[model samples]
Target: MSSFKSYFSIIQVLLLFGYTGFFSCGAGAQQMASEVKEVKAPKLLFLNYTISKDTNGTYRATFINKVLTEGRLKDKTQRQPLSDAGDIVCIQYNDKNDVLDRSYIKNPLQPIVEYVNDDGNLEKRQLNLNSAQIAIKLQLQEATSSVRLFLIDASGNASTDLITTSIR
Candidate 1:
């Protein structure tokens, strides 16, 4: 009977700690979100390429690219699982609004690491070379927004394959 009572006490203590920890974590996350929300940065980042286009009318810019994003979360780190989250890849326009550079990059608010988690929260690891792609249009007066990519290295070697999407 004494052992049973001791075991029950241990369980009770554990429950108390667990509840405390849970509340503490929730409060921390809320604080973090508020702090990051004050920051000003692009919500979406992507890579785009100019595919085939009609050169006859002078509108000859078609691009293809990928976009990365963490929807609704001000902090990229506080994101849903990659698979569960919406499209991380995106297509966008260039900054200059001319000639559809098809090889433009934008700076991201933060870097991201490709990670899979069963906990439902998307895990992000900051890469070294952060970059983004965009497409620009001149004559038609259509320019898309900037798309940013997080590189794992300063030299971007590990991200070279990803960077390839920018090439013609």
Candidate 2:
């Protein structure tokens, strides 16, 4: 009977801690969302994107991003599991206005761990992946509003891929 009582007490304590932690985490996430609503770095980060263009000259850019958040909440030595929260931001422009400076990069964001060729194995994508892909959609003369995607790095550098889509 005494052992059962101890077990019950332990369970109650765990529940209390669990509830407290849950609320704390919820508040933290809400705070983060309010602080930065969109990503602003590392231009041309993309897994893949499809562009649908038409006449009339409308333009829009949409961004889909996953941020890497690391926390030492579990064991001090071991980090917590990753959090996968998707942030979607969109900007729009019409050919009638909003001219932007543009630059292009090919195969910009590499997200591969290793490659095996005639050589046994080659490690790859090291130091990269500071962020996930930002899906951008361009529509010209079609009246699309999505404009740009960006991210702020730890050093507070705003890395961005800029595009100019408007009438002209």
Per-residue lDDT over 17-97 for candidate 2, one digit per residue giving the tens place of the 0 to 100 score: 999999999999999989986643223212233222235322223333322222222222211121122122224444444
lDDT of 2 at 8: 100
TM-score of each model, in listed order: 0.25, 0.25
- Model 1: per-residue Cα lDDT over 1-168, one tens digit each: 999999999999999999999999999999998887554333344335432213341112234645455333233331222221111322234665233322222223234667878987778786533233334221111344443222223443323222223321
Reference-based lDDT, each prediction = 0.39, 0.38
Best by lDDT: 1
For candidate 1, the 10 contiguous residues with the lowest summed lDDT are 78-87
| Candidate 2: stretches off by over 4 Å | 39-168
lDDT of 1 at 143: 47
